[model samples]
Target chain A: MTAKKIHPGAPGLLFLALFLLLSLPISLRAGEALVSGQYLSAVGQDIKMQITVAGPAPGTLIVIQNLPIGTVIDTASPAFNQYDAGKGEVKWLLTHVSPGRYIVNLRLLSPLAPGGISGEIRYKNPANGRLINLPVRP
Target chain B: MDSEKPLAGGIPMVNIDGARIRRIREEKGLTQLYVATVVGVTTDTISRWENRRYPNIKKENALKLAEALEIQLADIIDHGPPTTPPTEAPSLLSGEPSKQEAPEPQPAGQEQAIPLEATAPPTAIRANHRLASRPVVLFGAFLLLTLSCLALFWWSTANDGENQVAAVRTLPAHATPGITFPVVIEVTTTSSRSFSLILKETLPPDCIPAQGKPQFVSQASDPPILKWIGKITGEHTVYCYLAKLRPEAKMDTVHQFTGGVTVRSDDNPSIPVSGTDSLQVSPFHWADSNSDGRIDDEELLSVYETYGGIEGLHFGKKLIEEIWASKGYRFNPETRSYEILQ
Candidate 1:
């Protein structure tokens, strides 16, 4: 009768397999940040621009609207902090931004140019003061 | 004698151990024919039942066999071999304890603990039957545990294994007295299990937090401390505050920020804030992230995304734009701010 050969490392192999199973990564993603802008409509020469932000309100969040140099600025709902007409930059310094939609309304002087409105959102992640800049979407 | 595993609502059947049946039949000097005839089965079926080849049989058939053997249904029900001798009067199935509840006198053939052993191939099991004997399996398991612990220790030591949080500290190019710079630690959780973690940050001795709590887990420590307890939910959370340099902090001098994060749990995994052993105090604008004299197109665009709408910074976004439009810039020590070289 032939005898079975016992491999010495069998027990060790069994345990290594068990440990590998425990260390596999778990996948999940349930958080988000979005900055967007829309041209609602236009009156005789007054165009409307709406900016919205959906995120945390823990830190100061900055948004800027770069309009055409010749465009006239009527007013802003959540009033802008600065307006440099030479550069056509309408800036809003929104502080203590709470969770949910934060909107900034702008009444531009004329019908929007094809590429007239271009802007972005700058946020200082409070946890790690690292700055994240996201473009304001169309 | 019913197995704990759920059944499909088919006819009731049970696993017969057969060892007790054989012993009872032999003791009574009863031939297989007599027992088969009494139970109204062929001799072959009774033989199969005696050898456990037909381990599971109809519950009614089992009851008939018990009556023929002058025993109870539990007597021949398979509970995986005997641990104790049969009782004087065989009890009914109601008296039968579960396989787990019954005293187990296991032989050397199978392992009850390590589930991994069950996955071994038949040939491998035969091979490990000798090599993976109880003592060897126990030692291997212990060694595996020790090695796993050592590997985790080495990984955390090597890179701070930012496996829990990819956190970064926001430091201004330099610290200015009477002016508080931001101490921002942004942590993004990679795991979703709910638990609390305490972040302990050791600031440079030359600085103190503008305002916050539990600077120390205990007493206020020598180097001003920053302690934050966070109940982590799956979210993009940020921890930020302001800190100013001490009066003694000299111009052009740099101080490092360091700290550790401890997760409260059974394993108590503690991850040092990655790269905190030392850090460079880069002198640059929150806008000129790269510390270059110019906020080039890309950097300015990034600034717009990260800090464009952030409030409370004395520095203006227009200045960053001017810097972007300029040839370059320089830090005027007297002003403690960067200037565009128009």
Candidate 2:
């Protein structure tokens, strides 16, 4: 059997094709993207999460989920997102939680783009106000 | 494209493509703030332009904003004819228009000028003002009426005449044949008026006023007194008159006093002749008939015929003692008589 000669330009062309293919779905979804999940734990501790995402629209909705076993939420706290009629985003504050690790998953309802969605959830020592990042479970 | 000139007498207009301007801004991802800053104005000004407020953004600022936002000036200003049809003008010569008649459209170019004169006369506008002035006038008239009434009342009370008459009172006279007891009188007057006191004595045939006239005593510090005496036992009325010197004022009045008394004489001469000069003592002896120590009918008749008559009698003390001693009686002062000694 004789080996066929590989053309240099052909490799570059294949890579370009893969790049366009990956970017096509993101470009088509030019609407708002929302990512959200919750934190869970046992008693006598707290969990905190910092969320950030970018999209073509001015606002995005994010929801944090899976609170700890003895966790309480404070709805009246100052952790609120400024709402603009032209853009839509909703922020919520989950507080007075217990100790434990949790897996927080995110979803985008009207995603503007791909690879811009990311968030971090932490197990915080409520007494000391320290942060510890929690790992996502498979 | 060349800008089209507006027709004479027609209001200037600007065409706006709101959707296109919004799309361009979105495509550039520029906020309204960024555009307003580039145009040297506020975000609100830009919003006003986009919203198409009447008499939209000043011509100069609008042009500047359009250049900065990179959009055609026409895209921010609406220039088409009004959506509603223009109202018909009113005819001044016509009779007052019915309520249904369309109100006159405001002068086209001067829409903002307020036609104060055409709306209503200033007086009509101030009808409420006339009503407001009435209370002041009414209050003033009420004050004047109250003052006049007070003045009339004061004048009437000030002119009332003073009291000039006096009060008169009477008292009793001495206890005599013709006299009464408690002889006194009081007279009170508010003015300086003179009074007269009169005392008249009416006597019986056998008697006369003791001194030909009644005595009069006047005291400036006390009431006056009038005294009279008579010899016979009969009733007599004494009268007094008080008259004010001011004849024009009816203040004269009269008063009267009255009393009565009796007197007797001692005489005895009449008698009948007896056969042996036994004195014809008829054995039916007269009891105190003489009102003297001895019983004598002739004396009794003589006294009755003399000093009018004795009202009653006070028998002589010596005769009462002699009678009681012969009867073996003792005198008892409490009974005013003699009783037989036990």
Candidate 3:
């Protein structure tokens, strides 16, 4: 049998395709997810909040960063999976979560000012390692 | 006569004596109704004239009044002096001159002299007589009526327990078992009276006060009476308890909470008012549909169906969601299960 005609650029074309596929942004491939945070009440000297997450967020890292001054996580209530007190960040790492909604309640103790305080929450996509920030209004 | 009073119709004004009419009518033994009939007017007109409520009357009516009194017109009129001949007055009334009188010619620019009051209608004279006597009496009558109304108001309000003290109680009409809700009591008083006020809220059997040792003197009595004893001067409000309804409370049945408030002032004691409010425990627990104290996927689906299949249930749909959240159950629509994350 005669040998099949060899295309010289076939291997090069295959390598270029592989490079493009690997370099594609993970966020472009993943479904969009949302994160919302609210400061609920002042319990004695402690502050309370209810945070919500909507969409399929499996293997995601949820971070609440840049908290208002003089505030820290309260041990009396539910504890976060990971927290960096120096960075003012509270992190929750979810593994093997299904496509659904989730909510978390956190109580923080702070020497709050007279009027009110504000903060933000960030959602880290495990696939592309992208951070989405959600503001927490007064 | 007060010059401030309006003048009678004449070059020289006069004040009519209302008492003279009463005296003359009495002397003639004439009833006001009879006189009014003769004058073609209501008895009230005659009464008003005698009372001096109307300062003036028409001269025609006055003449009729004199005839009804069986008196001459001049006798009824209190003219101080006649500047003109009385014969002229009669001539004016008869609308004719005396037959014996002859016309006299006067010098050029010399006019026949006649008093304007004599030529003017008696109606004009009556309108000019303008003082309303007995204003003091009218003012006294009005004052008496006003005082009577104020007394009546005071008596009615005091008798109805409105003038002294009033109290009201309010509570949520419906609540889920083991939920915490507010109970409010308000007391008001019209007078700033210093008194010892006691507010007693009788909670249901399984209810408990969420807060301890409130600002007021608090006490717990059997049948769960939460009592506050303090001295109040005017108005006060007592938000006694954020009461947590026990899970053991009877489901689907309304439970009544009664409240009694009493005020003892320096003048009055034992002013007590009582009111009642009720709360019904929801028939089914939201997350624990089977009362298993945990949310199963089936129960979650049932909740979704009941809430119109909307996710992130809110507004009218937040009742069950709030209860479940209170129990530390975060719903996962993907797996359709509620997980307790610490």
Candidate 4:
């Protein structure tokens, strides 16, 4: 009996097709951005929260951080950010952000743990003025 | 030669797209001297017209220019201009001779009743290498991707040959759902002799053909293939078509256009179009002609002028009107519509 020679990469092509098919939506998608926050280990009474803004180009982002009742920010990198010590709030207004991971670090002076610290990333897409609000997560 | 008509407080002075003028001239195989001769202007003036150095010209001259180009006056108007103050005011009504053009006697009783300037000596104007180089650079980067696309079919296809045909596609920077946008394919062949050729354009799955210049030969094909059959004559040929995006197209997705120029040959037939071929769809309307997101009065007027007569196509004019009238707007993802903001 004689058998026909089959293309060895036939399965590979199928996977390639599948991979492209899966990524099609991702490739063709409009601008969708997200901001995430995670708490790093604390030293003494100082607590740190790392904020990440991930998105495409030309994004003007306004990220707001709400601290626990008694939390006061010691300092924040990118000195231009606004932090109200009395209100226990921090706001970072980022303009014309290029695509990539943008980091904003916040160090808080508080006796309380980071149990109730909350924040959100807001972006007003110029194309449609759709205010995108994504909550930061651990 | 679109002359800017000044308007009081409210509206901006009309401006012409210099880059577009240059493209039209280059695409039509018209030299600066030819246009200058017909329009009775120096090649330097013609060059300036094509370079935005003279964005506004007298309406009379514009009409002559429109006549010289064999296109309508409206076709040359810059539908979109920056909202900010114009960097430089157009050198209106100035035909001041630059050192570039030599003086020549005008022929009496020539076809047109306009003063003729010295024809550009043999070489009318130097090609704007800066504008030309960018596309070459972009095409160089995408040449690999297009070749890879060709390679997908290369296993059984004959794509091995010296590249003599080059093509560049001009697409609007942005495409909005439910609107038709123009696409131009510029094919330049090094060959002097005319030869039969097949130009195949592969549109995104969400795009359907609205109109074709010579009309596509192929009736239907999956993935929405558009083919134009014609002879490759002269050094350059331009093919154009309008593709309408589905009204419900998913936004933010990258849509790619892949195509090849297949000449009548046995060895090397297909040469893939090389350049930026992908465009993303947004909720913005195509009527936002200048692509500033919000449709304005002039842009809306242009929309009516360019696309109003087409039957069975609703370019979301009402929504555009609402957006245009409103102070601001936002796109609601849930409703898939633009809501007017106060």
Candidate 5:
């Protein structure tokens, strides 16, 4: 078959669209992307935790973390999350997050086991208008 | 015969005729010295009576002389002397210095007034006057009254603090052994003031405290000597303690415990108030819910439930190890009972 030269414009548009889709979450969540956690006591033995979030509106965060088996998350500042003691999973509903950093304090009791306390913070990215996940370990 | 009559003073007496005294003595052939020795008088006095130098002799002496002479008392005495006026004889009213010898003339106007000695008698008169004066009697009475008032004041003040009261109270004046009892001590102030307070209860030697040791109101334990120290005010202060009677308490005897409190006020340091109270302990069996004097698993569970589980479990498992276990108590699973081991 005889080759016909076609302009590469359509491919560029496709690449741009893919780029926009990939970068959508970052743009929508523009103001800031920050989350941090720290143990309120000197040793990690203490069950008190303080979590801070900065910028944009990270509305309704779902935090999934493993706690010592026997521990029950008894109390939290800004109020409590839906927590499952057996699964060591906790979910928080955060709204109207300010542009700067703010803290949420948490307390648990009777920590029976010791292991990595890892969690993914899921929030609605304001830039892409879609839910996004950020990983954290404190 | 007249010598036998009573004298003018109505004393039973015999009048001795002085004139017959010498005649009788000479007739007896008794020497005056011998008569004087028997009569317990000087020989000079005997001679004066026999010679009539003394017109009258005492009736007692007359009787003694007559007895010595072996004659009647009337033989030695003058019968006329007892009836004679004493003023006409040797009268002291005559104002003569030697009035013992005979009467003398006195000034005419001295009938009502007494004759005053120039110097010697004034001292006696002044002393007599001072004793009867109204001023001296009044002064003595006033001094006695003042001393009485001062003593009354001292007595009231000395006992004022004692009358102010602090008190102690114990719940269930009598308690059963192996059970805990509440003890309270109260203090009331004499005056409105801030003060330091201390409450103490001395447990009987056989008893143990549920809390391990007595916790003082503010201070440390003196043990067997339980005590407390703190500050207080005008209101009454109360202190509390929980103690357990020994499980092995004897049924026949009662254990005595004493409690006391002392209060020292800042304003009134000199006066401190203290009070004391007592409690008694008798035999009791634990884990015996039905009062059967024995323990079964059902009874143990019943007791645990009654004691409010862990919070009220003063004599729990730890206490079993320390106190009750050695007394032959063991848990039997098959029987489901806590029994006294054979």
Candidate 6:
């Protein structure tokens, strides 16, 4: 029988190294998840929005922040939902947003998770459903 | 395989093998009908073989079809293992080949096609397509319902049963003592409903409503005109109301209109006067010191200097030339006094 060779402190040392590396990124980015999606335009009057998260965990709360002034949330008809994590599509509807430039921030929150995601979408009108680029502030 | 062969007088079919058929169909930019008409076969047969509907097309005919369609025979005849049969064959079709039959009936070069005649009318199909795309239709209906409720609430509040009337009084300038001055009161209705007018005054037997109690003239479309002649001068309050009676019914529902005015009595005493004897006095007793007005300066200045430079000469100047103008008075140069003409 051949004797098996094993490194004495390899497993414990490897786990410690991984734990340290993971902790660094989590500390750097905390409180919110990073999200990205497309702003889809409807065939009718108002514009529609579709958002997706890259790796969304269960029980994550999402909120849209940083709306333009005088832009009211149409609570009369608010459409928002979370998609299956594997499916990768969530949709929200906003009506009578008026004609102007706006920056919509998508924020994600989790009770147990260390970090979350946030993304921005710009909405424009008149040219049917054109997606314009929005400059992000530092 | 035999059923996959093209039939005569039927729609023309493309004889290319599976691979070549797919390639040519995509390149020609023609639908399954185009290929079906080019060769003599049903579009279904073309779809079946191209999609590998049969185990295999006979080797000889497969080659003939490939040559006609100008494609390699092997590409059309896939030699790979047969696709596994679906777990459950759809219940709709019976006795059809379990694995080889088309899962959905499709045309020859077309992956999935419905005959134009069998398909829904264009208008109905378009409506259905639009309806399916709009998943927010229910939300829109709910929003309309909420708006209607709000409109109803506004309508109910606007029609609340209440009527209001307002009155304001204005007096004319420079009114004569013991004489009536025009006092105009503007009345306006501030309610959606309409009412009638009832004006009552505390008159001293002398002053009346110009007409009588329950006067109907004020209720007319235009504001009623009334003139009050002063009898006794002091403060007097006039009470008026809008006597709103239901249409075609007689009930005096008085809406009070109250106002007051101050009148000066003629019993106030006048200043007493005494005459001073002045020798070589000017014929005109009252003289204008500023010489700008008739006699306004006499009341302002107590002492007066004559234009002749005479000093220490006093004269009692009377503002009124005669006390009884109604009894007729005329100035007499000889007597140097005003006396009754009669």
User: What is the C-alpha local distance difference test score of each model?
Assistant: 0.60, 0.34, 0.53, 0.64, 0.52, 0.34
Any residue pairs clashing in model 5, and if so which? A28-A126, A28-A127, A28-A128, A29-A127, B16-B77, B16-B78, B17-B77, B18-B77
Using DockQ as the yardstick, the better of models 2 and 4 is 4
Q: Is candidate 4 or candidate 6 better by DockQ?
A: 4
Model 5 chain B lowest lDDT segment of ten:
B265-274
Please give, for residues B1-342, the per-residue lDDT of candidate 5 as tens digits. 544454476545545554577787676555565566456577666765554544444556666777677777645556554542321133343342322456777888888775554445777777866876668789888988998999999677545544365664534445466566555555665745464444556667766664522255222233455655555666666555667665566543555656654443212222222333434543333333344434433333233332322233244444322222223454343453345543
Off by over 4 Å in 4: A1-138, B1-162, B286-291, B295-342
Pairwise lDDT winner, candidates 2 and 4: 4
Residue B186 in model 1: shift from native, Å? 5.1
Error of 5 at A77 (Å): 35
Best by lDDT: 4
- What's each prediction's TM-score? 0.41, 0.15, 0.28, 0.31, 0.25, 0.15
- State how far residue A51 of model 3 sits from its true place (Å): 25
Task: Give one digit per residue, the lDDT tens place, for model 3 in B1-342.
Answer: 231122244433222344578789887655676566456577666765665434245566676788777787555554333222221121232334433334776786556666566877887765653333357668889999999999999787556544466677655556556555555566776665464555667777877766522443444645676666555665654444567667667667788887655443223323344444777776333335565554433343333333322232231334443343334454443453345543
For model 1, how does the per-residue alpha-carbon lDDT over A37-135 read when each residue is reduced to its tens digit?
565643334445555655544345567777778678777778776677788877766655565566677776566756556677776554444565767
The digit string of per-residue lDDT tens for model 6 on A65-87 reads 22222233333124443222332
Specify the CAPRI tier of model 5: incorrect
| Candidate 5 wrongly placed segments (more than 4 Å) | A1-138, B1-162, B211-214, B217-223, B265-280, B283-342
Estimate the TM-score for candidate 6. Answer: 0.15
Predictions: Cα RMSD each: 26.4, 67.7, 30.8, 22.9, 39.3, 48.4
TM-score values for chain B across all models: 0.40, 0.19, 0.35, 0.41, 0.33, 0.20
B1-342: candidate 6 lDDT, tens digit per residue: 322333353432223345457676566443454344234345565665565444344445555445435467655654455442221112334335645444876567775765654578988877877887586777778888899998888666444312223334432211111222122333443444332232222212222233221222222222332322222112222222211112222122222223322111111111111111111112222232222223321211212111111221112222222221122343354453544432
lDDT of 2 by residue, B23-128 (tens): 6666654566555544545655455444333233344555655765567677655465432212112224234433335587776779677766458888876785
lDDT of 4 at B17: 69
**lDDT for A21 (candidate 5):** 97
Error of 5 at A130 (Å): 75
